[model samples]
Target: MAAMQNITVRGVALCDKKRAGNVHVELYEKDVLDPHDLLNDTHTNLQGEFKLYGEQDELGTIEPFIRLTHNCKAKPGCMRVGDYVVPTDKLGGVYDMTYVPLDIVVSGEGEQCI
Candidate 1:
């Protein structure tokens, strides 16, 4: 069996067409059934950027995913938070996940938010 190699994933989060800072971002092994299986957790910076690092087999690869959560539109007695998922292909080697947008929307009483 080959030795384990280090892998790094990076990306950005955006909500409502703007940078989403302080959002909870988690990285998990693909196909994981438990939240406890999370590999790493990091929050976006003021510029909505984040990075995660892990290890995988040199001969093989590990599937990774990014989950993002934000509460940019929550209100009293109402829930307008946002949840997003980004499943990534096997990272056989070090690579950049690049910038990803998680556009969130808020609507109520049949009225659209502008």
Candidate 2:
């Protein structure tokens, strides 16, 4: 059997059509103060959907869950081809994660973690 350190995290990402560019996600414990994480580059994508998995450390401390949901909100006039992903105007993103126990079922309020 795998060691108790075998903890996994999984999730899906969705964004509006206006939101373009790639997305990134990282995991962390509930309380942590840091801009970077030990588990670097947990999530990355060139498509619309995003998923990630990682292990936990002692004290059950997982890396911070980071995400890039929005990008390239700027583009003067119009850029032809797939070159629409240009950062010039404005960009915003949301970051969150749901912790699930592998040993038991979890009851929640809503789907998508928010």
Candidate 3:
């Protein structure tokens, strides 16, 4: 059996350096053969700041990441999604991302029209 592992992440979501509120932030644990496990999720406050913490019991080290969904200057009826991975060594404590600018598309960023 494995012990429960935990993670804490906090940051501000911005678009062109301005606060981007209501952005959906999700924390997930990477899994090899199954769908990624959703640990926690929340929306940034009016200040564009968010804080999330989650825990899971796994046989191996937890590979965690944060996925952000936002409109951030996208055309109406479109949204952009980005994923920021956390270093495995950063688990079990707070990892402050500080600021995540949404204006710039990050690696693996995808756009969805809805």
Candidate 4:
């Protein structure tokens, strides 16, 4: 389904081939994305195992999905969907695609939005 300006993506963190952490969905534009930008809503080690819900201008599913990027944090993992790097024994887990209903808290913009 083409969500035009908004979409919901559900995912989970796979560590040691097992789901270790809850999945997250963040809206970031490549031209202006940094680790610090995302660290605001959730807390996690550089390993990236957390969940967050934020609104972004879809801009049509920005490249190198945030899902794969977070998954690759487990040593030798790097956005394998499009930016896959050589796999290493650092963490022997894999990613899983799941559909968890994340209700949209707001459809319109909000004030005090960081």
Instruction: Give the winner by lDDT.
Output: 3
Model 4 pairs in collision: 17-92, 17-93, 72-77
Off by over 4 Å in 4: 1-4, 22-26, 32-52, 57-64, 67-96, 99-114
Clashes of 1: 0
When sorted by TM-score, best at the front, the candidate numbers are 3, 1, 2, 4
lDDT of 2 by residue, 1-114 (tens): 322232233434333332222544444323355444334344334443444443444454333333332222223442211101112121122222332211221232112212
Per-residue accuracy of model 4 over 1-114 as CA lDDT, tens digit each? 433332232344454455443333443334445442231133333333443333344344432223232332332422222222112221123322342222212233122211
TM-score for candidate 2, residues paired by index: 0.37
For each candidate, how many residue pairs have backbone atoms clashing (under 3 Å)?
0, 9, 0, 3
Q: Provide the lowest-lDDT 10-residue window in model 2.
A: 82-91
Query: In candidate 4, how many clashes are counted?
Result: 3
Residue 93 lDDT (model 2): 23
**Candidate 1 C-alpha lDDT tens digits along 20-114:** 78977776655445443467788999998888876645344556655565655545443233333333444544455565555445222121232
For residues 16-72, could you state the per-residue lDDT of candidate 3 as single tens digits? 999999999999999999999999999999999999999999998999999999999
